[model samples]
Target: MYLQHPDDPEKGEVSESDSIIRTYQTYNKPYELQPEDIISLRIASLTPAEFDFVKQYEEQLGIIRKLNQYNQGTQDGGNQNNMRMQGMGAVGEEGSGLMPIMLDRQQTGFTIDRKGNLELPEIGEVQLSGLSIREAEELIKSKLINYFETPVVRIQLLSFHFTVLGEVNNEGRYTSFDPETNVIDAITLAENLTDFADRSRLKVVRFSGSEAQVYYVNTLREDLVSQKGFYLQPNDLIVVPALRARQSRRYLLPATTNIIGVTASALSLILIILNQTQ
Candidate 1:
């Protein structure tokens, strides 16, 4: 149980040593923007912090921006109840709740329509689906050129989330704000695994369009950092199976207790009969 993660890698050599090596590797494929994905899109102009350009565009473009959809929402119930919409503004200084609310990763923010189009205040609808975060940012910045000389745009993906099940303390869908979420970070989010969790046989199931890939990992090894499953993607499912002994005990302990109880009852009845006879 205490092995793997050798101090050195040599031909035909192995050692059992815990390592604290920190090797950060980027994901092979970045998550592309998906339709119906929720993202916090912030647009700010340098020097003058105001949305005066929006009013001008309304008259010039003859388009109406239903900005009330951004301002007039009492955080809905469920997971979004705790997320507060503060300092909200289309574009302004501090305390101005402009476009994009940091309300939460799952509930609040701009939702891309099913057509892969994101509707903005001035730029109307821009196709953001199938584009990476950096690509989307540059596209949005280009669209803002007609409005301001220099527009600073920030797009934070809030729809990145994963699921944890089996042996974890809290088994549910968890939101990860960081783009590079590791398996260890996910375990911590689930409040760590249960006592019966098998540290050596952790399973990571990753799903693509119509295919699912599974990976088995040992949480105790230092080589975990170099594993392909180290960086978790959206919709990844992590399952920490229980040890064999733990699974056996689940069935064995209750049966053993029942046998002991029956034996005690039989002994009590025998003693009562002997006392009556005496």
Candidate 2:
């Protein structure tokens, strides 16, 4: 039921102008890292001794994560086996009693601690929170100069996720590698908005520090493309509300149809009974 606007304007209608020009320019803007943000840091051109020193810690972390996953799997399997031996119970009883285990096995990325600092292999702890991606890369590069000759430092943000809810065809959370993801791009990921979606009252909720900001968008307007809320940030949520007419059709129409069906059936039964009795 999702509808896409026409790519070309029809005859006698005004052409759709570009939305990018009206919206706040986001070109060349880098996203600032925050606490709990995961980032991938790669260091190259290290001497053999330096490589050995860093490799040791990396291997240790990898081995520890593998062991943890193995232990968790073994424990879960043992519990399931015990339940099976005690007469397998109901169909979903075993799984119902067991809690789902979520494991964070990201070995390559560095997680920013609550203190907004990350402790590297040899570079030690560096304050990274509130710094843009480019700034973080330069800061880490400067720190590496003390150890390696012309060290190549590459930094990338690993967590860029957003959510789309309400009257979308497929409402769910999605991940994007592109930092300049727009509102249209996010909606496209969810298979676009449903026909019943209220084009005049779309909402984008964004969090900045401790404050939550909401931006209202009108998709039907020609200037929607130029709105500041068009460009979505990490953890931003886009909600498309349903039209009032669509809501009535969804809830009331079905009940009305059911009532009409039951009344007609009862009337037919009564007529048949009268004919038989007469």
Candidate 3:
């Protein structure tokens, strides 16, 4: 069961002084992934600044183009793959018998390292660090054809996991299923962002190659929704910020103290004047 620290909600951050409050440990949070947890995903609430960062990093990393090609399917007819139907004997194609071979790279339970590479069993070191699941499958199949009899291979995104930190219901890691997974889908899987989550301060931190980049997404406004497109790559990290209540309270405290001080001064002057006149 995943337990959230109560002190995490208060000071906007979990402070060292909050170690005493252990109320969440009593509930025995469910061990399984709950639908409610996804809503609090980091991408749901992004700040304008962070959004620009996301755009900048994506532009440099080729994430945008890759995602588009992945979704739209290549003009070269990659999407026309009828392997499933061919395997079922709906239509007989060459190597149809071997089509039953499931070698979907994305289907494999593995995560790409910083270099965009995966370590396969017999294949040894297969470089798939940046390529999408579909792309990786093609590379693997092309290579495996030499060894097997009409090698039947299918690749899948076995572990589509990402981490979400900061102001959300369940601020931890969430994994997604293959193909249907996306940014919004992950957030939905995390149970959606909480009301106290600052929609204007959302961030998506990701590691590209050996370096890490942070992209900002905004949930406060809707202008950029169309531009976000779909699907999140593996190793993405989202972070939602705390609400403005803490800042507002900090500002009000000093003002209230000043007002009280002014009122006392005015009263003292009035008393002085009265005494002088007497």
Which candidate number has the best TM-score?
Answer: 2
Q: List the residue pairs that clash in candidate 2.
A: 23-226
Runs with alpha carbons beyond 4 Å of true place in candidate 1: 1-4, 8-28, 52-108, 259-278
TM-score quality measure for candidate 3? 0.43
Separately for all candidates shown, the number of backbone clashes (residues 3 or more apart, or on different chains) is 10, 1, 40
Overall lDDT per candidate, in order of appearance? 0.75, 0.75, 0.51
Model 2 over residues 1-278: C-alpha lDDT tens digits?
Answer: 12224453466775567654333333334688899987767767646654644446655766675566556666666334212222334676664343333333244466899999988777789999989987888898898787777877777777788999999899998878677788879888999888889988889999998988999877776556667787788899999999999999999999999999999999999999999999
61-134: candidate 3 lDDT, tens digit per residue = 34444444444543443343311222344355445342232223232234455555554445566675445445
Cα-based lDDT at residue 238, candidate 3: 82
How well is each residue in 117-152 modelled by candidate 1, as lDDT tens digits? 988776789999999888999999899888776877
The TM-scores of all predictions, comma-separated, are 0.68, 0.69, 0.43
Give per-residue lDDT, candidate 3, residue 124.
Answer: 65
* Number of clashes found in candidate 3: 40
RMSD of 1: 8.3
Assess the local accuracy of residue 246 in candidate 2 as a C-alpha lDDT between 0 and 100: 95
